[model samples]
Target: MSDVDQSQLFEFLCRMGDNTLVLGHRVSEWCGHAPVLEEDIALANTALDLIGQTQMWLGLAGEVEDKSRSADDLAMLRDVWDFRNVLLVEQPNGDFGQTMMRQFLFDAWHLAMLKALTGSCDDRIAAIAAKSVKEVQYHVERSGDTVVGLGDGTSESHRRMQKALDLLWPYVGEMFVADAVDEAMAKAGVAPDPATLRDAFDARVEAVLTDATLTIPDGGFAHKGGKTGFQHSEHLGHLLTQMQWLQRAYPGATW
Candidate 1:
């Protein structure tokens, strides 16, 4: 592979790893705080699953970049602008319904992306996708079910769920906007073009939202730049302060 390909590969891998890393941290915040013990445990497990995947994705990214950085370094050291997560994942977890809505939307796209990547020309990427798809399969199911139950449950629950969807729907666009890196990865068969995954994502989301008796908002306007490391929403910086404080203060202190 050429140097340019390698650089794009690193960018692509960071895109994958950073999504899980940022969302996993956001989910972990719910530990001991979920409305019920069952949900608390479930959220924690989901966070753990995502973080475990992070190690593999970011570890491979480091190797591809031939950098000495480990997954820990990437997760703990990056500033807000240096990170490549989608804006959806970094948005504040507003309510339980909001959190689950974010999870469902992202899981729908994430599962579709991972399934396509299982066939990546890069064996390393294929292996990561194969492993991640299993966990994401369950994630999509759980989140979809939650979305339906909440969106269809009581009038209040339904109202809340719809509000959450409206708040979050704008950020969803960034996930499907293909940039130069996505084009390169798609050209190399390292991953699918972001545009190609949309039909499946839309199908799944439409079915679930229908079952939940919810409506998708009209008109499509997506916020961009998070995955490209160009800009992130204000929320991510606050999250990083809490997440990176220990590492920044201690600066290599280890257990």
Candidate 2:
């Protein structure tokens, strides 16, 4: 492979790894705090799945870059500016309704991306996607069900759900925004171009929202600046500090 292709592929892998790592951390925070025992376990399982996916994706990324970095190193040692996760995943879990809304939005796009990625020309990418798609399917079902419940249920739930959706809707656009990394990887058959997933993502999200009796915000302001590594949010740093402290202090310490 050419240097350009290698670079793009490496970057693309980091992007995938970072998305899961950050979101997994966010979800994992719900470990002892979920509203009910069942939800606590369910979200914890989702978080574990995401963190496992991150290890796989980032392990592949480490190989692609030919760097000595392991998946653990990539996840725990990287500084904030180097992370490529979209801003949506790093957004704080406002409340249970907000967290579910964020989960639903990301689940829709993530599942679509993985479905397309299952056909990736790169066998490793395809293999990972094939496995991950199954897990993400569950994420979609759980989150989507909750969204419908909250949006279509009582007055308080409906209002909170709507508030969460409005606050998060702008971040949704970042998922479908294509960059040079996407262009190169798509051309090399290593990954799908995210731009192509927009329509289908929109349709899936709309269907869920409609069933829940929620309205899509007319807001045209889409937040950006995460993929290229210049994140405008402070949450990532705070999260990384908590996530990386043990690894940083202990260096290679394992249970």
Model 2 accuracy (lDDT, Cα): 0.92
Which ten residues in a row are the worst by lDDT in model 2?
Answer: 1-10
Model 2, position 191: C-alpha lDDT score? 77
Candidate 2 residue spans exceeding 4 A from truth = 1-4
- Per-residue lDDT of model 2, residues 133-241, tens digit only: 9999999999999999999999999999999999999999998889888988788777788989988888989999999999999967889988778664888889988
The global C-alpha lDDT for each of the candidates, from Candidate 1 onward, is: 0.94, 0.92
Q: Which candidate gets the maximum TM-score versus the true structure?
A: 1
TM-score of every prediction relative to native:
0.98, 0.96
Off by over 4 Å in 1: 1-4
